[model samples]
Target: LSMPKGYAMLGRGILTIEGVLTFCSPQLNFVQMLEDHAFGAMIKDFDALKEFRQIGNRLLGALSKSMDIPSEIADVLKMTVRGQTKINLGITEAAEPLNAVNKMVDKLVIGIIDAALLISSSLICTTDMSPKIFEIPVLGMMGYFAALVVGIWLLNGIIRKK
Candidate 1:
């Protein structure tokens, strides 16, 4: 496809995705919290969306290659392609807000841990301890940060699991 045509297609896809995200934003959080069985159903829906995208892409490619195709026929084909593309785009757009929410939740969890660390550090400082034992607080802080990183990684894995 020509660059202009491809960009136009992308623009339409983005707009459609934006509309879908707006429409579904309210329910996104609830959907994320679903049990594994229900989440499997959601994954099926995502797979269907991916299939629609693939079909749309194939239709567009086929239409582009057939020079002898009538304009009327081409128009119909383009419409179908764009429609399917929009559905796929919408699904992708809907996922963005959910990702943002997950990041926010992860940050909140980390913040709570930080608060606890601060409280514990203050309590530890009040005690008279050997210099060697003082190393424990520094190590504890390092371990807590390491745990934060690992926890976020695991959470992302859980979220992305099929």
Candidate 2:
């Protein structure tokens, strides 16, 4: 027996799903790459700073034990180390807000991708003649709107850079 036209429709639906993923893949990749690079750099810097602090503390301890350094001088050095430790704590505290911002960005990007998938699936599922014609304009309008928003965001970033 021959297959019905619905079989072809099923194939088209699969293609649409693939296209949606293809469209969003680059954006997801870019976000992941940027996040990885940023986290890598931050971790590298934090580790370097931590190692330096440890080395300095060891050196100071050695000096206090071996040299005839006065107690008052040692006390001042201890206070300095305490202050630096507090500063490092403050940096960590400040990072909480940055982490929140990163989470928000992740949610926003996921929302955009979900919206795109929803729109594409809706377009694919509409089998009627009239609605399918109407959907094309709506889809085009949405595409234009998204492009406009992205352009504005890019412009804002460029302006802020200068």
Could you give candidate 1's per-residue lDDT for residues 13-121 as a string of tens digits?
A: 7667666766888554332343566878877778777789999999999978786568768877888878843333345567789988987788678767756765665
Model 2: colliding residue pairs: none
Candidate 1 overall lDDT versus native: 0.67
How many residue pairs clash per model? 0, 0
Write down the RMSD of candidate 2 (Cα, Å): 29.5
Q: What TM-score does candidate 1 reach?
A: 0.26
TM-score (C-alpha) between model 2 and the true structure = 0.23
Check candidate 1 and list the clashing pairs: none
Worst window of 10 by summed lDDT in candidate 2: 125-134
Question: What is the TM-score of each predicted model, taking all chains together?
Answer: 0.26, 0.23
* Model number with the top TM-score: 1
Candidate 1, 108: how far from true, in Å? 1.3
